[model samples]
Target chain A: MKSLSLKNLAKTYFDAYKGEHVTAIRDVSLEVPAGEFVSIVGPSGCGKSTILNMVAGFIPHSGGEILVGGTPVKGPGPDRGVVFQSFALFPWKTVLDNVGFGPKMRGVPKAERDAIAREYLALAGLSHAADRYPNELSGGMQQRVGVVRALANEPDVLLMDEPFASVDAQTRMTLQDELSRIWEERRPTVVFITHDVPEAVFLANRVVVLSKGKVLAEVEVPISRPRVWDRLVADDEFKDLSNQVLALVRSA
Target chain B: MERTSRISAALIFIAPLAVLVALWAVVVPVFGVRPQIFPSVPAVGRAGLDSILDGSLLRHVAASVSRVAIGTVLAVLVAVPLGILMGVSRGVSAFLTPLMRFFSVLAGIAWIPIATLWFGYGFGAIVFVIFNAVFFVVAYNTLLGVSTIPMTLRHAAASLGAGRQAMLTDVLLPGALPNIVTGIRTGLGFAWRGLIAAEMIATDVGLGYMLFVARDFYQTEVIVLGMIVIGTLWLLIDRLILVPLERATIERWGLVSA
Candidate 1:
């Protein structure tokens, strides 16, 4: 695991429809120390996804320096793993193969990679699903695979873009719980992007609220460990933190 | 239950062709149709028996099937890599797409006349026609398949440490497989028609040649037998081989919508 730093991040693009230069992200800087879970929350079009994309190296930032473990970010690399909201599991690959894909790319032997995949699948509580195709699983189950597939690579930093946004509310909570458990156990640096206020607070060590491509506020969550929706749902500290982050988002 | 349904489905498919044959059997004899135009069922059956006994039927069928198999394999081998190359590079795809569209329309039997001129009216010519028929459609569909893959899947693969070769094998290839299979099916449809047409014009030892030569001699029974063999061979190839391949991969994997 490694720390992530974004210094003076800015994005400006030519808008074909508007026929003018549009600035999406304007001068934002943030740091996520190694093993810390930082969730960036904002309303739609606030460039939250853009920030994550830039960090993941999926898109080039117009002006910025993104450092992962003190190394400059260039393009997408194995050091940084990404979990997308779309649950982009390879439909043609069985669950085991999908999870094993990263190790396979690294030229790990078949038996060793399969073992690694199995271990990760167990971590996500998805051992029974190993032989099935992605389409055979429900949306939630697919996302569980997505999370483990990323984790199996053992990347230095894990980037998630609204990973739970598309699943049902109930399933989302369960996924959040699983993610929290995984993070506690593995302690990989995470930069999670979402629009949900409670979700941001529930999962992050600190929540960074953004508006119009700039960080509006950063709030620390002192909520105790092993955070689950069951307890966090009724916890005053959790509610207060969520409300504080919600206000920052709304004010933005 | 599945076995019964499969049997019933086969029966349902065969019923219409059986009825057509029955209608032909009754009409040809009852109306006293000229044997020169359409031979009696028994006459056609006799011709079939004679060809089988003489081993001519096996030779013609073998010749045609081998040509199609060789041509399709070569076309797929070349087209898949080219299509993937086009899929990854916008400049290449943009330049080639228009060319592919234009040539695909001229695929199949249209190429036979030129093919014969180039290859001198033999195996080369017929195989060229079949290759021409299969190549463009598969390449174009492969391009469609690769382009249609979601961007995020590529992103995920890249972030998971996939390099150029791994990206092709692990993501682009499998991601494009459903369409590749679909393309092969459609291209082979064209190739089949083109093969018969080419064989008629160029080859001396195939089912199409059998039909064409029989026409000159007014041996309508032989022609009818050749037609039956051609149709039956295609049905068997498509139903037994291609459909099952499609079901085992794309359909079973739920890659395509029902």
Candidate 2:
């Protein structure tokens, strides 16, 4: 695990239809210490996804320094693994192969990568799905594969862009619980982006709220470990923190 | 259960052809049609038997099949990589797309006259025609396949440390495979027709040549037999090879929506 720092990150693009340059992210800077879970939440078009995309190196930042473990990032690399909202688990590959892809890219032998894949699949409770294609699995199951696929790479930092947003509510809660458990176990630095307020608070140690391409505020979650919806749904602290972040997002 | 269903499907498919043959048997003699116009079923059957007994049918079929096989293989080998290269670059695809559209429309028999000029009237000319028939379609389809791949998949691969080589093999190749297969199927369809035409004009030892020679002698029986062989060969190729290939990859992998 390694610390991720964004120094004056900005993104500006020319909108062909609008016939003008529009800034998506303007002067955003933040620091995520090693093994920390930080979520960036915002309303639509607030650049939350843009920030994650930039950090993941899917798009270039207009201006900024993105450093992982104090080394500047030039492009997408194994040091920063990303879990996309689409689940992006290669449809042509079986669940096991999809999870094994990272190790395979790193030159791990077939036997070793398969073993590594099995271990991560076990972590996500996806062992039974190893032989199945992504399309064969449910949306929730596919995202589980996505999560573990990133984790199996053992990257310095994991970037999740609204990973659970597409799944249904019940599945989202279950995924959130599983992600929290996984974070507690592995303690990998994660920067999660989402528009869902409670989901941001539920999964992150700190929630950053953004508005109009700028950071508005940050709320810290002091929730205890092993958090689950059954216990936290009605818990006062969880509700308060969720409401606090929701208010920040709404106000933004 | 699956095997039985497949057998039943085959039987259903054959039923109509069987009925058409039976109608041909009755209609020809009942009308007392001249053999020169349309040979009786028995005459065509005897022609088929004569050609097979003389080993000419096998030789012709082999020549035609081998030419098609070689041409398609060579075309795919070249077209797939070229298509992928075009797919990866917007400028390349944009510039080549219009050319691909024009050439694919003019692919097949249109190339035969020039092919014969270039390669002479023989196997080379026929195969050149077949190659042209297959190449443009496959390349165009491959380009379409690569371009249609979701950006997120590439993002996931790159972030997972996929380098240039790995991205091409692991992501682009497999991701574009379904379309490539589809292209091969469609291109082969065009190539099969082109092969018959090219063989008639440019070759002395193929099914199309057999038909053309029979027409000179007014041997309608041999002509009808050649037509049946051509149609049956295509059916077998499509059903026995292409469909199963599609099922094994595209359908089995759930790449295609229901």
Candidate 3:
């Protein structure tokens, strides 16, 4: 059964200055099941991020509706945590504060909020740099803080919009391992959006390939946990999945 | 640059001014000008001593500083919240932008003539002029700051469960801080100039009025002294207060990288 439902979602951008209306997404719909890691891979500007943004309540749908766990999304709440492509950590806030931001907004007491932040810090392997600002950290370290910040809230759904796209290849692999560790410990309804084929295949339980604002395919992986990048890179199954995703995206 | 390097660079700025001062000292006697038109530097120094000896210098400085302080604090108090509110609402911002622009252009010196007419040339009038100057600049800067924040950032905050106030404090204010600080600095610049002009016309005892009165007696020493005091005071404000405040906010924001 699906945990989150998307029905005929549509979005448009109205350019008042130029007196033109451009449609960004048109009646795109899909369902994400509970406790499953789903990855959406597509060409850039295929309205992939727009779908996630709609579900996350960042932008209003021009048509149809999106429901999270049977409840129609009106606006973003503390129940859904998001990690962005740019790391989006508050520059003025230290690592600890950024991680703890959700709870802080929810009016969690300082002592409890600090404790929750610390727990997530350890989980994300960023406990040592809790006091550092986002600018002071390396790209990987900044992304680690972003992950911890999302995890600290422990929302029903984890929305990732190209969270690893900016990091180097080596750091990306390490982050993928850490992401697997987090998902294993606490299985949330995860929807990861990316334009990277290998990235989507490497971590997702099911890969949803999109083309022109439509779902081209959803392929499930029977791969096991503690997946090693080296072994996966050499595996026939990984290569087949990667090629399939690559072709799907390339065709799109 | 490193911290020490930045400090040295700041100190290096003083060299040009020192040279300018030396040239002015030498040029005054080169033309053999009368003391009535342009007093010797030492005569201006003597005038400074007389003002200090009578205790009026401290009183005037203290009065002007307090008025500016009070006016600026009040302006910041009111402008920031209104600016934030305007930023939050699309309809409101659209409607208010024209009105705010109208007022911002009319800030400072433009308001002095009318301000004195309303409050009758005293502390109230001067403070009001300063208040309007600071208020409009800050409000406009805040609006610009809040508007310039990438919609992606605000959306990111919302998706992460930031409610109205949290979204404001987290995304809006931090994002707008650099602009707000800049606005304050610029506003204070206009306000300082307005204060001097307003004091000249509206008050009997202020730095501007003192200079104007000294001019009646051909006391070139006092006029030059007043100009020096005005220049030095504004420099101190810009250097010691406004510049640091703006730099700190921009640094924390990372909007403008070092």
- Global lDDT scores for all candidate models: 0.93, 0.93, 0.85
**Model 3: per-residue lDDT, tens digit, B1-258?**
699998897779778878877877877898888999788877888999999999878777887777788889899889998898888788988998899889878887788788878888789889998899899889888888899887766776776678778788888998888999998898888888888888888888788888888989999999988898888899999999988997787876566862
- Order of candidates by TM-score, top first? 2, 1, 3
Error of 3 at A101 (Å): 0.3
Docking class of 2: high
TM-score: model 1 vs. ground truth:
0.99
Off by over 4 Å in 2: none
lDDT of 2 by residue, A91-128 (tens): 88999999999999999999999999999999999999
Docking class of 1: high
TM-score of chain B of 1: 0.97
Q: For candidate 2, what TM-score does chain B get against the true chain B?
A: 0.98
Candidate 2 chain A: worst-modelled 10 consecutive residues by lDDT = A243-252
Scoring model 2 with DockQ, what do you get?
A: 0.88
What is the C-alpha lDDT profile of model 2 across B1-258, one tens digit per residue?
999998999899999999999999999999999999999999999999999999999999999999999999999999999999999998988898899888888899988888889999999998888889899989989998999899999999999999999999999999889999999999999999999998899989999999999999999999999999999999999989999988887998788892
DockQ of predicted candidate 3? 0.64
Give DockQ per model, in order. Answer: 0.87, 0.88, 0.64
